[model samples]
Target: MRYDNFPDHSAALPEVTSTWSYHRRSSRRGAEEINDESAVSSEGEKEFLKVKKRKHKKIRATSQENHHWWYAFAVVTLLAVATRQVGLDLPAGTVWDEVHFGTFANHYINRTFYHDVHPPLGKMMVAGAAWLTGYQATFEFAVGKDYTPDINFVGMRGVSL
Candidate 1:
């Protein structure tokens, strides 16, 4: 049945509860949740509210823990880099595979024509690094040979890393 008058409609509607207004205020103000509401009559509702509050607190705690993990990861990464740098240019010599690849890099710097079974991109990058380090590309990079102290092989190694 439809009510024609406003008074009849208003009288039929249930009274607004304090719980609803309290929740609204809590949402707006981030205030402490009110548990002493007379409107919450069911035990199940109170338990559900308690669970929800706990969930919110847990989410905040998890985010803080996640942030700490991110910082830990960063520190570990930095330590890894530092340790790797300790012996980055150790042995001071033409290491494994440098014979072929380093020759290719020298060829690129000298603009000399050479044939290789592999792609030339990695060699080109090494040659670019050599240019940055003022390497003359004239130094012979023989296999199983130690690099002389004069060459800036470390710079090339840095670029390779």
Candidate 2:
């Protein structure tokens, strides 16, 4: 029976005779019921929960991977510092090109102009470090010569580190 002639309160009664006639009486309410039945079904609810758990697991794994990278970076930084700092002042004498650079640094301290193929910035830094360490530029810095007691050679090499 057509429910258009009945009052709105009458539509809420369970007197609806056929599925098609009941749906036509209240189309919006009928659609809501259909949707609720499908979504709240046991199988459908279980599948929804499974998908949510998978998404949460994937997000947790991604966060753990990010932490792994941070740990790796920290380890590498510590190793690099340890390798550079160990035996920094060993042998107690000039090694390699220190003979030439040390002479340039001495010239800078003594205010005497000297010619060298290298750029002046590096020589100036060494000179500044030597000055800060109270080195008097008295040592000749000759190859294979042992460092004097007052040269502050460790402080100068620390600048390179």
* C-alpha TM-scores of all predictions: 0.53, 0.51
lDDT of 2: 0.75
1-161: candidate 2 lDDT, tens digit per residue: 99798778866777533444434543665443333334343665445545545665743467767799889999999998778778867879898878878999999999998888867888788889999999999999888888988788887786663
On the 0 to 100 scale, the lDDT of residue 63 in model 2 is: 73
Off by over 4 Å in 2: 1-75
In angstroms, the error of model 1 at 18 is: 37
Candidate 1 error regions (>4 Å): 1-66
lDDT of each: 0.75, 0.75
TM-score of 1: 0.53
Q: How many backbone clashes does candidate 1 have?
A: 1
